[model samples]
Target: MEYSEKKALAIKEYFAGGTTSTKLGLKYGFGNASVSRWVAMEKKKKRKFEEYAASIRAVREGMPTDVKALQEELRMARLNISLLEAMIDISDDQHGTDIRKKAGTRRS
Candidate 1:
């Protein structure tokens, strides 16, 4: 059964008119199952659209969206860098390792 926008609009109109799918299907020449399927599809589309709109609104409000994960990752990176620098300093001082890069020419 090929459904189109026309049939969908008719379903919406019949629904808005306070009629049941059983009656609307009879009037629209489709079975109740078809009408229900069309309504369900429309509902799913509406939910997805609403979610997308909400995300857009969040961004417009300067509320960083989808950044919590990035923030967590950045925080971990900083911690790791700190730990590595501490290890390097401890190794250079206690172990007498000359791995640290020199900043400039040493004066005689």
Candidate 2:
């Protein structure tokens, strides 16, 4: 059975929040494999997972936006990240313990 894109996306969003496919399948009345496939397909459709996830987040928040709007929002976010990283760098210099986690470091 074919599901609507909206339904597939809703399932994908829930799955992203650490929900297992088997549980989601039982809740949504579909097979576990189907839930997995739907989530995988949604992820596979976009090249950049982070940006795709951001767009999905925006949509879920009830704000329908065009590509231009998304682009502008992304730009603003990048600027905010730059500002935050600068602040973190400054704070780290003034502190004893490392504040920022190194890339690929396992959480202890």
Candidate 3:
């Protein structure tokens, strides 16, 4: 189900009023994890709106873009993606599980 920001804030406020996540989630017909995530977001004091960290413009003035070159690059990117996905599939078959970027397993 889709949750609204207003509902999230209300849930957060309910949490602030000493209500547990599980209880609030049950009352609101959502999972406790969702309630906790909402609370965490509310606790983080940051800008309400999202803004780009870098320029939104694709290319700068006086820099011309080539259509054929761009198309070739896109084709190469798609091929690379397919290759990576196949590799992952093979690795999963060999390992019996996804070994790439396993949760809670960090490289030392």
Candidate 4:
């Protein structure tokens, strides 16, 4: 049976008042496992909502310093990659080494 919003609210209220899932399910006319599953789903939704709210609060407080740190790290990584590519090019030119690719293959 589809649970109406009112029924769901009543069940939640009953659950909050220390009612067991088995008791609530019997009272609500559903299986105990269904009540337990609904409660578990609600808990997961509540946690996800709290997490999103926290992230929103963090953004509102400031641009989240960790994000700035990560952006800086990414920029540094790109620069390092470019420098490494240049070094590889120079090494290949100077030593005639195929360090940039596997042996017997032209792809780099």
Candidate 5:
């Protein structure tokens, strides 16, 4: 019934993913506008925790060194990069008709 308890419950409901924040807030008696703030705060908390974990892992591991392991990691990284680039190209092709047209004009 307390405000913090209501906010905590709203946050949990929002992160569970299927439920909209408005529905969660209404169910939990929080104002609709506060739902967006609550979701943003939850995202920031998650991001901070992830960054902290990565820093801790980096300090503990001191980085990888084996040549084979390094090569495999590099290969995976390149594959991921290529996949991301392809996705960007597809997005640009789908949504950038004006920009593409201008670039084609300049090339002529």
Candidate 6:
């Protein structure tokens, strides 16, 4: 992983637990003071992410159920789910066919 990604993951792990910055720095191979900076940067990124997510939720939740916006979202979700199910079914069918072919080949 890149240094930034590693640092971000470390910061996330630290915040999700009760670990100290010093301990995190030692474990993550960063300077003790760098841990504080990384944590702050991660917090800013998280705040921005949360804000964007909240806005999206608001747009979805505030829409009337009968409105086109809501209908479109529902339609999209249903389509996506259908596509995923179809893909899974195809994969399972292929796997089963392969297994049956292998079994027949072994018997012969």
TM-score of each: 0.51, 0.35, 0.34, 0.51, 0.54, 0.48
Distance from true location, Cα of 103 in model 6, Å: 71
After superposing candidate 6 on the true structure, give the runs of residues whose Cα lies further than 4 Å from its correct spot.
Answer: 1-9, 65-108
Question: By TM-score, is 2 or 4 better?
Answer: 4
Q: Best-fitting candidate, measured by TM-score?
A: 5
Please provide, for model 3 over 1-108, each residue's C-alpha lDDT reduced to its tens digit, 9 standing for 90 to 100.
Answer: 356854665565675697787887787777889878877776553334222322333443223456667888999999999999999999899889976786788778
TM-score of 5: 0.54
Q: After superposition, how far is residue 55 of candidate 6 from its true place, in Å?
A: 0.9
lDDT of 2 at 7: 61
lDDT of 5 at 51: 100
Candidate ranking (lDDT, best to worst): 6, 5, 4, 1, 2, 3
State the weakest 10-residue window (summed lDDT) of model 6. Answer: 97-106
Candidate 4 clash pair list: none
Candidate with the larger TM-score of 1 and 2: 1
Please, what is the whole-model Cα lDDT of each candidate in the order they appear? Answer: 0.80, 0.76, 0.71, 0.81, 0.82, 0.82
Least well predicted 10-residue stretch by lDDT in candidate 3 = 47-56
Tens-digit lDDT string for candidate 2 (14-84): 65697787887787677889887877776766647878899999797765557668989999999999999
Model 1 TM-score is 0.51
Candidate 5 clashing pairs, residues 3+ apart or interchain: none
3-53 per-residue lDDT for model 5 (tens digits): 888888888878878988778878988777798797898899999999999
Off by over 4 Å in 2: 1-6, 48-108
- Deviation from native of the Cα of residue 87 in model 3, angstroms: 86
Q: What is the lDDT of residue 69 in candidate 4?
A: 85
